[model samples]
Target chain A: MITPELLLQELQTAFSKHKYGAEPGELYAPIGYIMSLGGKRFRPLLTLLSASIYTDEWQSALRPAMAVEVFHNFTLMHDDIMDNAPLRRGEPTVHEKWNANTAILSGDVMLIRAYDLLLGIRPELMGKVLARFNQTAAEVCEGQQLDMNFEKRWDVTEAEYLNMIRLKTSVLLGFALELGGLLTGADEASLQLLYAAGENMGMGFQLKDDLLDVFGDPAKFGKQVGGDIISNKKTFLLIEALSRAEGTYRTDLEYWINAADFDKNEKVQAVTKIYEALDIRTFTEQKIREYFEKGLNALEGLPAPDGRKIPLWQFVHQLVERDK
Target chain B: MITPELLLQELQTAFSKHKYGAEPGELYAPIGYIMSLGGKRFRPLLTLLSASIYTDEWQSALRPAMAVEVFHNFTLMHDDIMDNAPLRRGEPTVHEKWNANTAILSGDVMLIRAYDLLLGIRPELMGKVLARFNQTAAEVCEGQQLDMNFEKRWDVTEAEYLNMIRLKTSVLLGFALELGGLLTGADEASLQLLYAAGENMGMGFQLKDDLLDVFGDPAKFGKQVGGDIISNKKTFLLIEALSRAEGTYRTDLEYWINAADFDKNEKVQAVTKIYEALDIRTFTEQKIREYFEKGLNALEGLPAPDGRKIPLWQFVHQLVERDK
Candidate 1:
């Protein structure tokens, strides 16, 4: 009965009511701004949905759920600086809008604020909650480090790349779900299942991001497709293409990747063509299915009856099935 | 029976044994690198010394003591990027050695690792400990932001400068001492005293740093004098001098400050003469003494007998009385 729409409304209310800090507007304003920018609130949504499995008062999980969102935006705000990104959600990045120093300092505070929010749960849960969160948080940093390391090298294996994404993007999602369940006082077995499902689902979600960047419909995708291709970002599709491509395919892919000057559209077209020849899309789809099935299977193991879990199921399914 | 030298040796051993992270060398090596760069270890030394006042097994507080050290270094790593400083302790900074992104990410993990180290304390203490640490961490970030805000303004007041340094530099030192006492099961009233004492001590320590930058001898100071004056950095002295100077004094000070081109020694000497005319050094020394006395007075309130606290008292006096 706890729908994603209801979760979204409660999250917006919580975020607005929350005051990050009062001093030095430069440090706290960006946190409110980024949280307001509102990128689907997927992690928090997942948290509330998971919390619903154990209690009807899923709304109680809102603050910790917001912690996941705050942590996510913290990474994005900092990552934008690392990637030298100009726009996020079609707005100037925190660094671009303010300055890199503001972004860095502000982002640092947001990370702490996330921990502050995490502290809102029951006292008995503090030890477990903090330990798990610390682990996930460190892994996210490690994941980002690996992604940065992969930037200069073309020899990055798929395993290394997957581990990077798993650590960077996926673990938090897992933590989000696990946190909700833990807060709701779900048994250990159920919490484990929830974490596994959320983590695998996160991998699926990221890979879907990779696919949609190339193959998603322009009208539906909202953003331009082939952005990953144009940038030669080391996404799942690109990694797969690099691994499978040989001779002519390899030559064309490498040429565009290294091209100092070329039309962006042409690079996209050429790379998409090379990817097509390598059946990278199908390979990506299979990987996506594999992850989704793994996640769904874990979710199925939960004791909550199918009737009670419909909304959460549909929410995750929408992520998997969407083209955008 | 506890000695400062014994504390330093234990701290160094703890730092050497600590493993920040593994796998991605780029992400974690800088943690080891910056920590190894080793400033005076003042904060950790304070923590362990504070612990000694409460328990003979002060060595048990080593992990949390290192937590203070780690948190301090985390700030340095990120602040180096914000300040765009190239050197930390006369060696290249983390960002200079590994780049800004690495510094940012590694600094983040260091912050979390600080919390992880805090977890080494008892479970029952987690809530109070995390809440206090969170407040201190956020305040530190706020202080850095204010420091950054001061960069462009000549209107910065002495009070504003003190608050900034207090937030930026003092609170963590306070927390470091307070944390050691908390870990060793100090009573509520005593813990409060330790925090106030350490915080004020930190203020004195920083004020001394500002004073030493201008007045300390080059042979003993180990770094150049008047570096703050040369940069027109809005430290306590500059703020005071700017406020107090009038007529001919103001005119002469403005000449050195605004002169786009001048010999470094000429600038230093001109600034020093202006400061001498304004009696700035005495004002700075008086302020430093005020803070040191405030701290020492609080330390006096602790139940520990005078003999048992000799090491702690001498350690503080050494900081107060040092030429450098």
Candidate 2:
């Protein structure tokens, strides 16, 4: 089987081969712009690697793998509009670069294009694939809505937050792996295991993101170390701390959260101190480890041989070990 | 084969059978809301009627036919946001009823649901149907973009306007007919003919809408007659008048277009008089006739017996004859 590195190169070539640009420059420009402003291409790579475990014909999964990536960007484009976010990947968002209407319309086209990308997969698989995609797409939206709904409330629970992330962030990752398996005709049990693996890994990845936001070296993280704390963004650490904080810890968190004016660093420092007092770091790390272990076990449970599973195994290690 | 009237009832029943309501009512309530604020179920009716042309198995097309209706409402929901229109079907628009973010997210789900509706069709037909739906959906976006682009320019030509309307309003109608034929395993030629017939009829329908807005009786039209004139909206008559006017006629047309303030009735009267002077009504009627006849011709050329085609023929007459 081709290594993950080589499969990624092929994925790049596949992406370049499919142009998002078309007439009515306004509608298509942002699609091309966002696709060009690349991320890790993490989801598609996972898809290809997941397929690599089953067959050497994993190259055919590249285009369908892109469906996940395109759909990911589509959600981001709309989510940015909802969040009224100014920057994405350290640059202006589609809504900011153009306008909300442009972002909304362009994001819409990106979604339709995602469906277009799925067309050439095995015809028999198309119906099931489409059904899964539709369900995931709806869940993502529901997740966003729940996330938004949480914003207006002060009592968001850890369970609620985790489920939100699973729906909003993790399900697509799960779908990515499931799609690859589906395309390769992986057995029912295997597909389920693959999806569970990705979903668990995704949970670990999101919690890692939470940990990095408050704890990682800013230079390596490439973002403010305690930005979420400063913004009082409800994250795993915050939720855990909120759930566990007692007496002064609770008072300080609420104080900073409700403060009308305070130094950004001071608020972040205070929040960090409270999280430490609450053992939030250890708590979050333990949760992250649990998920990562569950993910590893799912991968182990796959019917593929240890040799065939080695690449995916390595990729998951790399995923969980990322500092930023 | 079932009659169009019965097909419509079946379509309504099918629509009710599939609830848009789900958890995270925030993301779904708008879907149910918009679908419930119903209008003429014209597109899906054409789908079923077109299928009736081919076989008695047209009843099998009901669920798939709902796809076009769902897709049509999806466009309207998003377009309502982009146009900043406060009302749809005489009710508050989704964005107005909830919020823009709700509208955007709910609209996204609606589009995905449309894909879900298409999934249970013949497995072989799923791909072609999806491809066509994707293409049509993109054209609708492009057309809306062009329409928005025209908003900033006075130089938009009659041809540009026609093409834009064809993309925006006509193709989906064409797709509706084509989708029904496709679901019935209609031959390639019949599919093409069905699409073209629907496309031409769509053009006529849009033109007739343009004509009715300015000329139809207010009570009958269920909207303010001359509302388009009041807004200076670019339509068949206006585009034709803009292209054909010369000398004093040009001055009057330009004056009305540029006027910052004018009495609504007076402006409507003046524009109507100018249209009469320039023969814009006759001009628009001629264009409408051309399209409707082309649609009729396409229908007549279909390889179906005349008796079997009569329901579709009668339906087209009803569509063209609508005063509103």
Candidate 3:
């Protein structure tokens, strides 16, 4: 009967309770600081909710749930440093408040703290839990490397970009839910299905982020619209436009892409025009919907699924359909 | 009866065998590549030697020993990036060969691989093993952060710098020996003494490094002498020199320290003259020997002490007394 909002609230409270205490404060305070910046907490909440569907005492999953949150924030702290980003969630990043070295060292400790939190899971499941976590951790690193690699090359394909995001972003989501199921002693089939569901939803969610960067209402988006477009970041719409554009349109797109100095508004407008000409946004939307459908289908495949799953499903649907 | 040389060779072979076979070889290859560069493998060899003193099957400690090696290299990879050092053990650093981004990612995966190796230890002892490893990991980060913080301030005290190096450099040595002892199920008291021994010895080893920078015979040092003095680094001698110098001597020392551009050799020679006048080298050597003696006392206190402990002690003694 719990709504997604309620689940998220519970997760937020749990995360706060486990917040780094005074002695290790320097090492872990940034983790609490970053997590309290009001992230979606979607991944950890999915862990708790998925565990709830199988077991009554979802509270047992709290520590492991925090592990996911800690791991996510750890990655974010380091990623912001690498990206030289000044702001995250419309606020100063950890490296901005603290130095990059502090951010890097603190992020490293946060990852270790994640492992410490994960060690609290039932001893019987420790091996499986650690194995899955290790794989997810490595994949996350691989995804990051690929994302960085993408920045150097001009010819990144749509499939390559998708795979990079899937590995870097979606796989963690998949592991978050799969971890919940494993902790709850769910059957192998159920665990696999849940992982697939989370992953598909994650793909859809990222696609939505890319779309919102350009098409979203600025008021609703909570940040600058077309930020990615101005940066000439290779998003799905841009990649599709690159692949499908012809002679004259292609030349214009190339000019905009290569131009080091141009009116930001003018460049965004011109690129948006090309995307419209190619129906790139429509194509991206269709792909997003396809993955959203796949995620829902995976959820549907669960045997005798509890009614409690509806709130999460509805939340995801709302996410996909959101303009921001 | 194993010499440090023989133990080092075995440690190298074991480290080389652990495949860091993650994709994007250019990114993850640095992990294996750096380990392959080989810096005597001193820490892991100490672990094996400590274990051998307790039990004959030191081979049982190989994985945990390798854990120490991997962890040490992980810190080096990240530290080189932070220090902006172009060389490691006379070879191009991971960041130099690949890039900072790749080095960061590869260093991350190396930490994961360290855990993977730690996981290979006997399951019954895994908790104590991981707990020690976690504590060591956090301390290492704390030390690195403190070292970075010290760089911004000129008032860094000798005690503060020593504490930083102890945390930054020595705790891992303590943990390595402690882990080896724990894996062999040595008595708790013996493990404690062994850890203390390693820690005190590590501190002495660091002091020796500081001493060698100024006082070492160039033929034995393998690099230009007084490199630390030339860089105006706050080593033990420099700190002592600053604390003890009076009037003209203090002003001259401050001048060299504050100078923007000066002959490197002249600065080193000027600092060396001040240090000689103050007998700071003799003072530092006395302090180093005191720690070495304390380390020996701790080693002698171990329960059911074995003769094998003698060679290990002798090896560490040799490290301290060596010109290099």
Residue-level lDDT of model 3, residues A17-83, one tens digit each, is 7855343355566777888787888888888878877877888888898888888888999899888
Best DockQ among the predictions, by candidate number: 2
Quality of model 3 by C-alpha lDDT: 0.83
Q: How high is the TM-score of chain A in model 1?
A: 0.97
Clashes of each: 0, 0, 0
Tens digits of per-residue lDDT for model 3, B218-271: 888998898888787778888888889998899999999999999998999998
- How do the residues B1-324 of candidate 1 rate in per-residue lDDT, one tens digit apiece? 688888898788888999998878888899999989878898899988988887888878888788778988999999999999999999999888878999999998889898898775677777788888899999999999999999999999988999999999999988988887888888999888899998898898898888889888898998889898888888888899999999998998899889998898988888888888889988888888899999999899988778868878878888878888
Error of 1 at B149 (Å): 1.1
lDDT for each residue of candidate 2 in B237-284, tens digit (9 for 90 to 100) = 888888889999899889989999999999999999999998889888
Relative to the true structure, candidate 1 reaches a TM of 0.97
**DockQ values per model:** 0.78, 0.91, 0.44
The structural similarity of chain B in model 2 to the true chain B, as TM-score, is 0.97
Candidate that beats the other on TM-score, 1 or 3, i.e. the better one: 1
TM-score list, all predictions: 0.97, 0.99, 0.93
Error of 2 at B280 (Å): 0.6
Local error of candidate 1 at residue B187 (angstroms): 3.4
